[model samples]
Target: MNRERLFSQLVSHSGPFDIAIIGGGATGLGAAVDAASRGHSVVLIEQSDFAKGTSSRSTKLVHGGVRYLKQGNISLVLEALRERGLLCKNAPHLVHSLPFVIPSYHWWEGPFYGIGLKVYDTLAGQLGLEPSRYLSREEMMELLPTLETEGLDGGVVYHDGQFDDARLAIHLARTAVNNGAITLNHTRCTGLMKEKGHVIGVKAECVETGRQHEIRARCVINATGVFVDDVRRMDDAKTENIVAPSQGVHLVLPREFLPGESAIMIPKTDDGRVLFAVPWHGRVIIGTTDTPVEHASIEPRALPDEIEFLMTHAARYLTRDPRPCDVLSVFAGLRPLVAAKNAESTAALSRDHTILVSDSGLITITGGKWTTYRRMAEDVIDHAEMIGGIGVKHCVTHDLKIHGSATVLPKDDPLAVYGSDATEIRELTAKEPEWARKVHPKLDLTCAEVVFHTRHEMARTVGDVLARRSRSLLFDAQASMNAAPRVAAIMARELNWDAETIDHQVNRFQKLASGYILEG
Candidate 1:
């Protein structure tokens, strides 16, 4: 999926493709893999870098919706649970099982949640990761040493799954490429190409070069997450908006806040939502306020009140109060909640996915969470094949391993983002010792990672390297800012950029990094 290969494929392909997919987030990339693996000719376009929006900003859990179970949404819970296990088996490098505990404040809380979680495990059937158990106060304290002890009772412990969302998206894109899917980033779909009021193809333009092309296809599928309505309107100007965006925010704190491997799940927050303090990338990720948003933006910022809400909630559960100064980075993402009439609030909206087929043959999929992206993709392809009159085949992605997921070998570097590909990266570092050096003094992100992702992972900007590829920006924005100059220099060398372009990259990265800083 190098720049040259992607560009060459885009220019050389001269056929009526079986399917054309818009958006390069989780669902779009997954559908590309699904269709291509099933022996269909497929092409996908992304306006910006892949996963630059909602897909990358997830809570990073691949769990069966335990909260959904509480609301008696058994079907959604069961489906998510099944996908959770499947993802763990398919992408063992990225998806791993995690133990979660619901700390209790009342005596009856233990039995109540413990029974509920047991039923959750039962729903998973053969796909269950682990069984649920009850943890005593002493045991809970041992796992969550920083938790507030005065009002604490025992806790209910259960198991779920977790992963790196952006990394998974990157791997999906690579997997799609391996399966013969034509994928291009920085390419925007301007409008739907129609013939006799049927969607025949798409009119796309490269955002970087302003070059436009008409990619004719037998069918067009829109998987644009929060922006599905925009594409739907292109197919039919009278299309009704189906997406109701809801904002969720997360804050990264020092790992000491959640020192153990087990994650703490607060089943009920003051705002009637759930809170989780999970350990990820050597840091603790802890708010997810469900505020209704009228619009969706790529780089959404956390509000001052949202930051205060998270801090106040943390103070209630933890012995140590993490001030705004303690926040390493804060980010916000919008969930594309499918609009339901009489749904009082966005929180009341279902997490289940919605797929709609317009009269003009546009298949748009939206409203699913990250845990169920694979199934959503499979469904999209199935619908597309039906509408386009292609010979549909069974999906192979349920068992297919993503790119660089084969090897189980371990690595010395903690920041080694690629699991099985660690050896290849290490070999590169041996040839160029400077590549092994950390870009910033305090960060373990090495120079080799910057070079590896730029040359292979379709990394075109400093933001892609530090933010998504290396995850430095998510951990510490100030440190990421410090590392930007070095990252930009290496990218300049790899992409053959001039001094002005390098400066521009650094400037843009710095602006993005600034948004992650929480107010003190």
Candidate 2:
């Protein structure tokens, strides 16, 4: 997890690695872990901080694709269901089971979804959390006190996995590093290194120091989510684009909007998409509108229409309607969906991953959900070994314990998300009393967490700490903006930044936080 040590390993190694992966999001990080654990010398490079893109901007659900199941994608649903169960077992500190109530306005709605969810449960088999069952109108209201009850006949309650997406991404990177993989953030891949029309390695440059390295490898993997085509074109200018970027947006609201342990799921929205209002880290996340986009950006903005769509739907389900001013923060993520020929809408694209080996032997893996990243990694590495002539090493990640995996954390502990690492962080507060002080009055982030992320989590920028490491920006945009000066000061002390750099960090973060605020 130490950036300097990892960077040294990248440059000092003379021989080619077994695998060199481009992209540090879910799929790439997963592949790094899978390959390294199997005794392959692996290196993974990212253009920015890990999960700075779509991985951190998820709706925070790790479940079988419910909408895909309705679309008759049984194979994907089955695969995701199995992976969901495994993730809960593998990363117990980050993943947890939660209940979701699908409210039914009409009587038939309850029976219809009830039967459908039963099939969903049957597909999960022994791995199912709790069986889906019908709940009476009175019972449903008790579970969801904030739900609108006028036309509510009853509801069907089901089970799904919930987690902190960015936190999980960090754990995956740590797991890969623990298995001896070289993972470098803020390193951009400039171009492919080919030998006589065969892919060999990559030309990468350190974003911070501008030092370039010609990194050779037996195999190179392009797992760069939505921007996969951008890397593909590097290998061959005539490479056909496989990814169709689909943008999904979410809005954060106060806990009072939900005020319960259970979540509400609208099975079918007006646009035939599913919407979820899930509780996470003491805030309610009401989201997700999927809209087609022509291009992808590292920081995608929540469109006005997407924001309005979520608020409109939130008003329909919640007794307390939300306003544009009520929005605490808004964020968006782009899905790296493999384009389908003649596919009318991005919604129709499959969640299953697609693997392509170019004529030059460059392996590209794109198009998969966060829930099934492990399976996608296993599949890609198996392909890499076959093409690269590496000896067979069967996948061991199915039972591999991710870094920081531990028993259930105490419910009141705020740092429970850090799992076993929470004990070390707690010790920091005891050693340095100033570290215990909250950075923002409205949020629980503290100076110790900021320092910890900077030193151990490869956090180099203020945005890396606020946006991904601690999730302060996603929880409350204005509070994070107000807290930036304090966070930057703490980071400056740790990273040895001058007064000018500190001011620049604070100002830069404020501008970034402004995009998350609707009024700004």
Candidate 3:
């Protein structure tokens, strides 16, 4: 489908849409796709760029939570495993199986973990992904030579899926658009439009032009993740604080630091959290320290204590000590967990999502992981349809094909399609060689991708392109800073932005990126 034409159609057309979804993260985007594919007129609005929140800041793993199995949450694990397999099948290019090694120090450790993993595989059954296998010390060392071999008896190797979380969200958005959903990024929902006592639509501001628009829909879905309570407050003052925002931080180290093909899954850390050293986009991503967070923000900054915690835990199994100096980048994300009445810690909070329709009639869906977004969307739509009295057909997103997703790889792969750009990039290497190296070595990211982001993917600024569309900023901040001028120049030419506008874009990007650094 022509996205530009569809967007134009949405802007010109005015009526009560079947569904209007808030937030552009995985849940909202997935809901949009499901609703649109079912023949419902849908509009999705986000305050920031899509996946700019917790959705993008994931561990990038699409696996059954192994730790969940240890906690006897077998149902959650099985469901996640099924979804992981489905995602891998649906988006082969974006999602691929990643083998992980769980190193065991004691002789019994291997068998014990192996048995658990075997149970994990058994739970998945045919739906289960590739089974886990026991690997000897020699085999483990072969897979990951940098692993600390001292007292290492053996290891368990298992396969789990990995994906570009932002890319997947983008694909979901595109799919929704393809199925005729109006998705507006940089659109902020300021208030809920109430009729008598029922929520009928939303009052939103376009972040770009600061223009206000009233979107009328039969049902307004507040799938704003952690901000669910804030949205709910518009209708009822006594809306329970459903979400307990928990902070999870990750540290990015150079690939040379790990030097391995497979990731290492630390089941339990000393601090009562699971740790993972996953290979992601050419960098070693060691993370995730879960702590309580009171305030919720778009950009969640990682604390120094969190970084030190990760380094200390990772050091236990690694050959070399990973210090703060070795850290390339650090990021933090807030998980919108449902607050349990008797829960002691955030780790014990339920990952399962909850959907609530308030007395004033605002449908809110929150507290779920990236892996179950589709299912969450389905549930949200089902709830919205019932509340709105809209008789929508069954969901078709289960078998829907997302935009830019192909069941088969093209004959001209990444190298072939990007080779010429690689050469041109090499010719201009001195000016900005990393740009060329990333795409083709001879060519920087081809003009096509940039155009695609703006024209189709709803990228409004240079930061959107670098940070989300291409991910140049996350990998190499300095290089992204250096390449900003060139990218802005390209954007200015296409978007017809004046010099002042280009400068504003560049400055905004710099200021936003500055937050990633550890301040004294």
Candidate 4:
């Protein structure tokens, strides 16, 4: 993933591409990987770093939607369940099975939910993980030591997939690049290039450098997550908005709050939503409240009420209540849900993806979750072939190995999340002992990981390195702030940042990270 070489290719390409994708998040990158692996000439551009928006800010679960099953959207649940299984198979290093316990307080709650989970397991069929089983009160407590137990009857445990969302996104981008797709971060799509009112290409500008390029494509796919409508309007000004943005917020807490391998799942909350407290990267992440938002943002903030809502629920479930002061970090992501006519609540809207070909032949794909990204890519590219008149190539991403894909990893090694690439990083640490130094006292991140991401993973800014590449900012905001100077220094040495650039990057990251901390 050499940005300089890719950028030169973007500038010097003589002919129009078979596919030009806008928005380098999950959908776009998936499309790039799917299309390119099928021998299509593909190019993708993102305004910011990959997964900077909703893709990175996820609940970190790769599972069939249990809530959707209760709502009777059986098709969605079935599709997501298949995709979830495939993701675990394809990216075993990043995605794995995680146990979830649903504590039951009432007599009837056990049978009711237990039957529902049985159906869930049935839907997954051969691809399912361990089956759901009933647990006695003693058994449940052993799994979740901190669960509140005043009227606890028993519990049911089920299996789902868990992963690092941003890390997977980076892998997806790398897989696309490995398959010969040019993916550029910090490249903004300014406008659509139209001939005779037919969408042909895009006018993009380099955000780092002011250089611009007119990239013509036979097919232009808009996979821009929450900001899909923004790109659609470039084709037609009067394009009625199709996306109804919904915000989901999560809070990161210490592992002591959930000091176990299994996670806690609240089947039903006061607002008819589900809440989860899952463990990731040595931290406990409890989320998420789904609230409707008018517009999408690059950096979404957790609402005061949303924070309070989570705190109230956390107190209800945990024996030890977590207060605002206990919060380590908080983040928010907006869903690009396709709007339903007369849809009163965003929660009722569809999680299934929608692909629309506009009057000008612009192919737009929106309204999907992270789990079904590969399927969405497959569908949109099939549509592109029919609409854009590109040569047909069947989808090959189902069995394609993501970059750094590995089956087994050492459990004690903190760099295991890097998959096979961890060995190279370990060699770097062995060669240069300074690279192995911890970035912060509280975090497992090392300076070697920062240098590696900047050199190979298209990491450009301190935010890109801390927020996405290493997930330091999401893990602990204050610690990430304290470690910013060290990270900027390492990136400076690797990417040749001057003293002024180092100061600017560190200051900018501190200001951004401060918002993730709840004021005591």
Candidate 2 clashing pairs? none
Candidate 4 lDDT for residue 31: 93
Model 2, span 1-520: residue lDDT tens: 8999998888798899999999999999999999999999999999998999999999999999787888898998999999999999999999989999999999799989998999999999888899999999999889999999999999999999999999999989999999999999999999999999999999999998899999999999999999999999999999788899999999999999998899999988989899999998989999888899998899999898898899999999999999877889999999998899999998888678999999998999999999999999999999999988888898999999998997568645789889888887888999999999999999889989998999899999999999999999998999999999999999998889999999998999999899999872
Worst 10 residues of 1 by lDDT: 408-417
User: Which residue ranges in model 1 land beyond 4 Å of their true spot?
Assistant: 409-416
How many residue pairs clash in each candidate at the backbone level?
Answer: 0, 0, 7, 0
lDDT of 4 by residue, 1-520 (tens): 8899999888788899999999988899999999999999899999999999999999999999899999999999999999999999999889999999999999998899999999999999988999999999999889999999999999899999998899999999999999989999999999999999899899999997889899999999999998989998898888899999999999999999998899999999998899999988888999999899998899999999999999999999999999888899999999999999999899889888999999889999999889999999999999998888988888998999888886458545688778988887888898899889999999888888887898889999999988999899988999999999999999898888899999999999999999999997
Clashes of 2: 0
Candidate of highest lDDT:
2
TM-score per prediction, in order, is: 0.98, 0.99, 0.92, 0.99
Residue pairs that clash (backbone atoms under 3 angstroms), model 3: 421-443, 422-442, 422-443, 423-442, 423-443, 425-442, 426-442
Relative to the true structure, candidate 4 reaches a TM of 0.99
Error of 3 at 344 (Å): 1.6
RMSD of each: 1.2, 1.0, 3.9, 0.9
lDDT digits (tens) for residues 1-520 of candidate 3? 2334655776687788889999999999999999989999899999998898999889989988899999999889888888877777677667777898999998888989999999888877776667899998899999988889999988999888887888788878878887878888888999999899888999988887888888899999998998889988877877779899999998877788677669999887888888999987767989899989888988888877887799888787888988766776677899999999888889889899999888878899999899888788888998988898889689776776665555434323542222223233334444544433343232235455665567656788887787777766666565667677777877787778999999999898878776665443
lDDT of 2 at 515: 95
Residues 9-46, candidate 1: write the lDDT tens digits: 87788888999999999989999999999999999999
Better of 1 and 3 by TM-score: 1
Pick the winner on lDDT between candidates 3 and 4: 4
